[model samples]
Target: MTNRIVDHPVLGKLTNRPPVTFTFDGKTYEGMEGDTIASALLANGIRQLRVHEGTGTPRAIYCNIGHCFECRVTVNDAKIVRACMTPIQNEMVIESGKMQPAPFKASPEEWPRTYAEFEKMNDNHKEGVPHA
Candidate 1:
């Protein structure tokens, strides 16, 4: 994928800064010097950067303008940075968190198991019948 955000709707093509190469989790990626880490990552097809700190759930960019805290990543020695607003710099170390594996409970076959268990003990109604 092209690492240049030339046709983006909001930022459009960045023509001022020169292109620079950097590594994200050992993968080499290229972006303009002025482009934000999140923008460059999206252009490079990297959607999920890390998992939530406590929940271990996958997280990625939610707001490209830094309003949301979804795109937080560790850069250099810094932690909890909004990647959407942080510009790229030479020799910057970006440590992206690993994606969480899909939970087994979310599988299609597991739905029946969960539904059956819910149906057995659900007694909220006066009739003691579980609602589907």
Candidate 2:
């Protein structure tokens, strides 16, 4: 995937600054200065930031904000951080994996069909469609 935003209608030429190198899941990529980890990763063509710990589902950036912890990643072998809110530093090491606790846990018997649908709507948002 291409590692730069080109021809954006509102944010034309999104990457104009010098490149900074960072590693994600053992792969090196370049990002512009001041780019958030999520933005840089997406710009670098990485779609999924983590997997659901229980179901092993692919998870990408949702809100692009701190409210949703879906973009969490292990940074520099330190604590897990919200990728959408954290700026990428030169030579930063990033590892992709589930970082937050499950939203809720329940046995299959306890989760009814309607509850499953509700959870799906919640994951994709209540708008009846998941964001691409």
Candidate 3:
């Protein structure tokens, strides 16, 4: 659980900023200021941010930059965003899950029961809209 880089050989003690608290999957963790969500999660010992939307395989941060699109996460129920580029903010609520599916119309009975329930749970929260 010790994810902080405490005494690096070259940089010495790395964490220098005040701590900020955020929630991941409903659990709170402390992260240093100036940390990207990905870095903060890693520092807090969290690897899996989500599952593959198509395959259901566990996924973590792949590229620390904004190009790879592998570090997508829902921030503050606002929209899916890249965790590597988004800086950590105190009291932020992050959710990990498959990417939102494409829009489609289906009968209430035709919708998958679990998906419907999940939608219900998220209804109070505004979905994060991806930027164009």
Candidate 2: list runs displaced more than 4 Å: 1-3, 12-15, 98-132
- The global C-alpha lDDT for each of the candidates, from Candidate 1 onward, is 0.74, 0.82, 0.82
Q: On residues 64-132, what C-alpha lDDT tens digit does candidate 2 reach at each position? A: 869989888899987559999999999999999964565546565655368777667467544755567
lDDT of 3 by residue, 60-90 (tens): 8887888887788899887669999999999
Model 1 — which ten-residue stretch has the worst lDDT? 117-126
Q: Which pairs clash (backbone N, Cα, C closer than 3 Å) in model 1?
A: none
Task: Order the candidate numbers by TM-score, best to worst.
Answer: 3, 2, 1
User: lDDT of candidate 2 vs native?
Assistant: 0.82
Residue 56's lDDT in candidate 3? 78
**Which candidate number would show the highest lDDT if scored against the true structure?**
2
Residue 10 lDDT, candidate 2, scale 0-100: 90
Q: Model 1: per-residue lDDT, tens digit, 53-93?
A: 64688899886787978888888869888898899887778
Candidate 3 colliding pairs? 78-128, 79-128
TM-score for each of the candidates:
0.62, 0.68, 0.69
